[model samples]
Target: MSVLPDPGATRAVLIGTSHYDHLESLPAVSNNLTALAEALTGPTSWTLPQEHCTILSNPTTAEMTMAAVRAAAEQARDTVLIYFAGHGLVDPEGDLYLAMPQSKQRRVETGLPYRWIRQALLNGRADRCVVVLDCCYSGLALGTMGGPSDLADQAAVEGTFLLAAAAETRQALAPPDETCTAFTGELLDTLQTGIPNGPELIDFGALYRHLRIRLAAKGRPDPQARDRNTGARLALGRNLACLPTTATTPSADGEPATARSWPSPSGIRTVRGFFKSLADVRVTSGLTHQMVSQRSGGRISPGTVSRLLNRESLPKTWHTTAAFLSACGVPDQQVAEWYAVWTRLLTDTTTDAAPHTVPHPRQHQKPTTLQRLTGRLSRRNGRSRDHRSGSS
Candidate 1:
């Protein structure tokens, strides 16, 4: 339901560091910056003027800050997207810092504090801000609760949306032989080719979900996101892979062309019931684990499919569940319904950690997205308090 940002009123700044003086270099980052910049301004995307997009490759901390400042100075009224691909550093206190060519491990001053970037974006006039980070422990940008030194205080901005390549404790993968970093490579491909059966416009919400499923299927670190004030609803670009309506029209036989009927996960209240439902769906699909994985276009591994069905514990995240269902040919609308069911179960079982026990539903209705967000935020805030300090 999101609309594309006004092309003439938007600006993008892409920063990357491929060669590092004190840290291992990510040679693929250079490719990420170039390709991403082109894609953002390309015809298939926002089509912003070339001048509206800025690319900074292997820049110093000062240069990176200056570029952010200059982009902010543009005072874009619609949207401003800032992307960084390089080494992400964290101090012992668990503050996130972006590494530059001269950045050293555990040295906060040597790298660019994420706060500086956040401040710059907050200073801009843009109505919405999008931040994409592809690096080790990039999820730290989402925030932590470690006292004044913590990044939590700076986490929220009225219209900010963040997409991170990995969790706070995980390292983002950058396969050496690939042309681009693992996260950015998948991202760029998605932007260019678009998702099949996707909407006309590709929004951040869809983009984040796509990345999470694709990465998890490949056994890579899952991406994370935080959005405020519906920023995730901002459209990023057109969907090149959306099919024509005529192609989906019913055939002369009165049956819809290419119809697929998958089992519904409706009215399920217990973890055991959910697991049983998943088993039923798998059986109904009549596919081997390998076949399901293959149908997922390699987004879900055969082993992962096997474990998902066989494991007694309910899936902890919607990403895994949606990936499995989509691979089994479930429609998008049904997948969304499944998400609601998952959220209801998650909310009901929040106080009870034991997944095997069936908890009575707190309310006999599907939870709205806002309700789900509230529950998730509460849980994340709680976890942040107990989270241990670490560096990646």
Candidate 2:
């Protein structure tokens, strides 16, 4: 099962280049950046803070690198998402570079090499990184040094997902009459409207599938994707298309009408309160422990689920908690919130177990005979030696 990124710890950097010195201008690139930023930060999506989302329009190579470095440095625990919508240039050696405003055709030095971005993500502290490239030959980023189609030897950072707009040998489309680039326009539409009857959260895997089908149907370039360590399952936005039209009816997740009244895990600090919230969610889900275990993809056992609800202590691992919550039909956003609370509670528990400041008391003991004799001898010798020494 996939866990949603904590919006508070996630960062998004959107880069676009619309005008070029020696290449055709893409007037739609600007719109792509703006619309994407709103979609990522809006309430229906990850709810990422506006300040956490950086948009660079027609930036110099230096400016783009610095922004990526800053984001990588700041995001330590959650995810880092980098998006670029512009011209993709290939070097003589077939390596990919993202074109900048000052970039000239076939000039490698004028553009930003994809290796720089790759290195930044590798050096960063984020647990996962997502890269979306919407430009010509963007798919080259997924190609290994050995072969364009051989993904087995791809040297991507673990927990990284790469989505390219076109194949390594193809050019992404930018229809002159479209508001946004062909690839990004479809992406924006998906984020704003979402998949009909799809999962509640729009994960990378689902998004890629949607894009592949939609773009293919339009006779556009097929999108390419490479994922490591289940990064494609990471969800960054909500599926607005799945919103229920009426609250009185059972929703897609099979929750009862009164499921809306279930207890919330927000603002819960104590272990007991957390468990109580879990129990309430389970109760509202109307599923037996066995059913929950099955829904969890067998990550948690039925006995473990029962133990979790009956015990007042927090679960030893977040994997179990997440699976349990997901099985109970909790949304990914709420699951992320629960993760934050679980983290704090676990930290407090560990801190409380540390050694205290006050020393432990010890039993009183009498001095030994040898120590008393030595003390008396030292006192007599001090008086006699002082008097003799002064006379001398």
Candidate 3:
């Protein structure tokens, strides 16, 4: 029988390497491991026991790191999660490799091949195994090198779910002024805040859908997810609140870009009416759907704009509603009106009859890079696991 993960028995290893002699160093790496380890062991977060988690910073070799991972897999009674934030290189044969401090270009043997890690987790008895790749070439987690396909990796990688930071050929850019990679930044944010009006458990699919929307809205390369197990509903974290927290960005004249006040949609009676109101705003404001889509920086698509106008219901998140209204030239003072209408509809009786499931708008797949590999690569290493946890 497969062992189920008891909260206290879960094992995690968070790895981030910033020192690459041959590659430009990624400054956000160390910060990524620190923040993730904290959240995973947080009281109300994943809540994994402190000792069960490991942090490896600047691991010197492939064999040493994979050994630590395999040991964790053997010890984990239920769930296992391995999050790597650093450099990911693709060998000539198109296989993906994780970069370490001593890695050299074209020397595939010096880096940790992802398949080595994947095979270890697959052989383990953990009920759920999630690998989050927040590095360059992270897309290789899906086993696809060049692009994001409608179907995930051809190899049936059972028991492992992969979250890629970017499609092939796109870099998972670090936010210039922030301490975390752009992908990891949003991830930590979602883990901290949870979903808006979403369920208590933010499951895998739910988490990825939200990521898709947020990244697309920010005009960044979209992230991809591959879950081989259809029945897997792994919880990333619990909803910290029923409603998302509010923060305001003020304009030059001291005008709030996004109002923090919670809107009361009590007066709105139906989803149709709610969307119709937005449609009427477009007509009265004399703005076309294309204009609104462009204005949101392609966050909200023209197709979505049409759907919100023509369709009957709305998604639960505030991102879409806020983006839509902001694109509509809706004044700050009055933006709350549409927001209230959408918010109210969530609790109103009309939602029951309206088919309320939110649709995930698909992102366009990015181009793939095909670099040639000539010789076989080897793996070398030192001793045991190392790196201090941020927590006491």
Candidate 4:
């Protein structure tokens, strides 16, 4: 028996976090959070009311996440959906848990327990609760806690379904490119345009199959579904006959008929805001200084890092600027978009291929110590080659 309720009457609380104080994290989590929120709230004309959806993001901390989960569960009437995208680890006791900013990988015992989440669902007022865990080692928490058979039995009585990104021993892949996590990206892609409505309801079995196929297409490890209750299933309920199958098409005028576009100023602000957000994350993660030195191969100085962060100096070459952004995990598309917008503002045309050229006040000045050392090494290598050639 599964613990999912009538899907049509469900209220969702989607949360995504990516930045871990320690661990290899991706900016994709933040992007996925934004995308998921849009999918739920956007005027895609899903059969459900938009007012029932709630979304949250906490890339740096888990304190807010706990509060959001509790509040959503309390407020939910029929069904509660919780989606998490971040890091997961196990404690010495073999208990699985999600990692927080202050989480100590070594002392995993202190991390937030996965059982806490289970207990939340068990105690929550909602009739059906769905948990989507999109993180590496996610299955460890659910798999070690109990077998799918036990969960199915519980769900038959209480209604609960857990979807894990991978098996206990496998690792889930991050976004292949600039998209969200491979699993989440596919989920959204399917939800928006794939599923159709009517007599043929998108069953849990079908949905999982769709998600699995999409993830596998991206070369990701397949996700496993655990159904604990046999009689439990997701239904649209009375208020909603079926999840809206019609895709929202654009108007003839090239404007979204239902979806609202950000105002020009707001769009510009969002672009700039994203950059500032990345900068802030870099500082908090201590990756800014580390990235500059790492990409420069010890050529960049701490003082140069200070200047770049303070905006007192910019990278003199496109390669350096791109590398710096890459180190901070800013997607190339986003950088290109920003650059395109800037070019349009200056030239009144959106299409431009001219490369960005940095203007230095003292272009003829001698190269810095780092450049001089590299130049000398190059000359020495050339002379050695010449001598070798003459001897030969």
TM-score, every prediction:
0.58, 0.63, 0.57, 0.50
Q: Kindly report which residue stretches of model 1 are placed more than 4 angstroms away from their true locations once superposed.
A: 137-156, 243-392
lDDT of 3 by residue, 42-85 (tens): 64355565787899999998878888799888887557888887
TM value for model 4: 0.50
Which of the predicted structures, 2 or 4, would earn the higher TM-score when compared with the native? 2
- Model 1 lDDT on a 0 to 1 scale: 0.71
**Index of the highest-TM-score prediction:** 2
lDDT of 3: 0.66
Q: Which 10 consecutive residues of model 2 have the lowest summed lDDT?
A: 138-147
User: Highest lDDT: which candidate?
Assistant: 2
Model 2 TM-score is 0.63
lDDT of 4: 0.52
Q: Tens digit of lDDT per residue, candidate 2, span 1-392?
A: 44456555678888888877776677888999989998887755665667878889889775556666566546645788888887776777767777898876567898887777778888888878898887753322221111133221232455798887765344456777789988889988998889987776678999999998999899776777889888987876666786544323436765445544344555354565566557656654667788888778898899999888877566667988898888777778888989999999888877886765566656676778999999999999999999999999
lDDT of each: 0.71, 0.73, 0.66, 0.52
